[model samples]
Target: MFTTVRQQGWVDGSAAITGITPYASALECLMHYFREQQTICKKCCHVNYNHEAIQQCKLQKVDFIWVNRDLENFSWFLQLLNDFENEQLTYLETLRANNVTSKRYIDFHFYFTSLKSNNQGMIGYAPFDLAANIYQNVSNRDVLTKMRTKTILGRPQWSLLFAKFKAEHRRTSVFFTGKPVMGEDIKRWCDQYQFMYYHEPYF
Candidate 1:
């Protein structure tokens, strides 16, 4: 069985980012992740003062669980995700958008470390997947650098690869509902997550 918990919570209103308004669907979730930067997991947290929160919405009651890209963290992360789901402690937009009709939107995935491995997480290859579509829209190394970042070993090389993949995936549909993300550093982060730009982009 499942239950609802009511307690104190925290939201970094000042730490807010711009993105799409919350829609209630997996497609919306995917689209929001690709378009907006509103309240992300990193800048938010849920607080409960009672055990009821943990006992509600067990993993068996939720949909799928996405593991991290790392195998070692996969199981642990799934359990953690389950705990959050059981407590109904997902993001506000995600909860409202997904729960209204399909309660299974909480499906978990992994952050893909390498394609060679079998392990996965909540969302894998998000950046690469997105880049593969609109890479050609990007023009020069300077613009790429201006758009993304210089973190990976081969910034120039990765940018080129990203561009190529995006060009191939250009036909993919994306909704630009939120604000436009600026800065090479921010763009780089979006690239890592597979978005050429984002509103209220995260680091």
Candidate 2:
């Protein structure tokens, strides 16, 4: 039998293990474990729909998986955590600069949940105004498609800006998720900055 690692934030029904075979590989086991945990969290949130609580559960799942030292799949979850934290920081900074209370601002949870459910990639846009507009307006399929198209069109500019941001934040470790093989430039960049490079196989 596959052992289930008990985590602090797990709810009763969400905590139970089922449908996962002992013969599954380590990566498959981790994915199954986290997927079940997410389902449990959603069920637990049915009463009050506490987004923060659900997010906490998700992070706890990542932490539990990380403790197993499964670097391959763990890296992707770590990147998700980093992205969420960085986005929240940007939101707070935007609110502070505008002299607005956080209560008046849109919660990052909404955007994040939408992305997760839709299997959408995070758009690391630095400008809070544009990001907010995209988040607030891209509630439907047509708008989401339009926004994605716009992003694709502006990829060149966004890439340059992201590169600059990485340079400025070189002290912070960057994790790249993909196949084990990395391009020469990326290898060189990480080596030059001594940034921690994590290569997670695409799942």
Candidate 3:
């Protein structure tokens, strides 16, 4: 299990944990700690602790985003196109409202080439069978390359597009959430990223 030194004097005035629960395994315990840290951070500081913590950990591993195997057909592509069109309209509205500034648009060549050469994370991609799919196909390098080439290049816009795509495609529900990283993997990732690692023994 895990034991955390609870911070006192929160705005919510919730009671802090005095004892740690005995989890079935180290992984379970760590996951619980992660969730607790996220909750405490959010409650106390209005921050997305999980995202911040993960980024702080700076794990350089290439995390995979999987699409639903059922959504691999042509119909799903059409749906994505429709969604993209709606997103385009929303973008135009934002532009017309003078809420966003326009910059010189670069074509797909510059975008895709950059992605192929750059070492940063890939954003969006279609999923395929892990065993049968090539590394690039499974890892979404191809999809991210296309997206970087075709879509707007700003971080805010890219985040919105990815969020919309994931929600509309039910990507998380079908694929990403299904394949969870185990406790050992989490510990290894934290170590790889140089995040603060802690596990206390039961007294």
Candidate 4:
């Protein structure tokens, strides 16, 4: 369904950020945006070629997850999460001493009491959502300036898009593995849409 190039891919948010400067720069501000929620907002769950790495944090009863073993992308983000019956078994220890820094971790509280899994993904509070959320929550001069000139990596093509009311769709989760693997070639595996890209993190 793609004219140019549409291939399913995976992102090691942690590893992927190292190359893109703008993304890396914006990431700091994004991190401050939620103390860690920024990755959930900006970094993680990116469209193809612009994907990010992974992370985890403890949030009351809910676990702030980011890493999905490759193959999961072929389906859908919410489906992978909804399929999660237990965090204890589903939790991926990709980051070894991450709890203290992100202040987030995995647990049993799913927080979807009255809501069903399918519809629960689309709720938002608008006006407040803009100020509180860092992902594309562009506003006055300060934030826009930081977005454009933060200088850590490169500039995000968000402010102008936000100004014009346009949106970027999450397409393929593309990322270069950048290294060689034993069994499948990263590029070839990505083309094939295999694990690390579409795997079952849980059962």
Candidate 5:
């Protein structure tokens, strides 16, 4: 829905993209952000997120994330953003509870089951992976092709080898939800890989 307008990014350029990253759509920008974890909106792009700069809109008054609308309901996608923000807060609280100071949560990695060090990354999910029939969850719930992140277990989905082409439409993703997974789904994925935690939780 937010991909209707041309989206652009001024970012920490990688070899694949250099200077003035103009995303084909908002979803593309999201994919790039998940992979790079770098700032995506330095020049007032259409889609803005927690990790981005202050755009024309004041920070306090704007939505947690801002994306241009295009007659499609983005409630599910907005939920994704909310989850991302909530997870960040939870991580910070976890770190504080685990004897890490608020000013230095970055230096200490709180050992927990299936907890990511940072929550800026992304992951794709099948419809059933999320809900029985997610049609009831989203305005545009027609299944589409599988959409993935930049890495296997590194960051989000894919880059060169695991890339999803033209990652906007989530109307035919029966193979996968073509959208990022959230909440308990993330724990399932992290536990499956044992990538984000130690075998024994540490204090």
Candidate 6:
């Protein structure tokens, strides 16, 4: 079972299924459980999700898994908390359309449900809150210093930016960023949160 009592702001369904910020941080947490090597977790960092970084992690026997807790994957959710194993996202996508509805379409309802839930399970909103606070203080800093430049699970998880905003506003506020090349996921997140902001979509 996951924890209840979610923080204010951010979509109700949006939760931090993974305890750490980046995938590396999650892996580091795992390492600390056994090896207790603080430096190993700190030094085992990645830049832009490269092959070398993944290879290094695998050499250490660390499993790279991105656990996003949405309402859509009942089977996978059971696997994550109970089975203690990672589910391949690739397979989830292939099965998403088939089991969701008769017509093919993207399923974001799980994320919506997660955000709306009172008990946020194991997910927390602290990381995004910290980002928003820091962004306001240092919005003019270098791109890499900002929230959006960081990636989660070897991919750009755009939700981090909104998580920051939600921290300050005390409500789930998504930003459009208004970039044409912006991903569908970003657009959907913003739509669900009723957010309206225009920028490069990158920090």
> How high is the CA lDDT of each candidate model?
0.30, 0.31, 0.28, 0.27, 0.26, 0.31
* Model 6 agreement with the true structure over 1-203: per-residue lDDT tens digits: 10111111122212333322332233334433322211222565411212233233422222122223343433443233222221222223334534531211111111222222223332465565456456656763212222222212122335764564345443332222222444355567666655542222232
lDDT tens per residue, model 2, 2-108:
22221111011111122111112333443443334332235554212223433443222211111111223333433443444444454455446656554211111
Candidate 1 local lDDT, residue 55: 28
Tens digits of lDDT, candidate 4, 146-193:
221111112112233222221222233333322233113433533443
lDDT of 3 at 201: 28
The window of 10 residues in a row where model 3 has the poorest summed lDDT is: 6-15
Model 3 C-alpha lDDT per residue in residues 1-203, reported as the tens digit of each score: 11222100000001111112221132243334344544324456532233334334322111122122222232433243334334334434434565454321111111212112212344332232232135445553334322322321212122343344334332111111111222244335335433333332222
Q: How should the candidates be ordered by lDDT, best one leading? A: 6, 2, 1, 3, 4, 5
Tell me the tens digit of each residue's lDDT in model 1 across 1-203.
Answer: 12211110111111222221121133333334323333334455432222233224232222221111233423432343334444343443444554433233233222222332112332454565446335535642111222221112111233543454355443211112211322344356445646444233322
As a whole number from 0 to 100, the lDDT of residue 122 in candidate 6 is 26
TM-score of each: 0.20, 0.29, 0.21, 0.19, 0.20, 0.20
Scanning candidate 1 in windows of ten residues, the lowest lDDT window is 4-13
Better of 2 and 4 by TM-score: 2
Each candidate: RMSD to true structure? 18.3, 14.7, 18.6, 19.5, 21.1, 19.8
Clashing pairs in 2: none
Number of clashes found in candidate 6? 6
Worst 10 residues of 4 by lDDT: 147-156
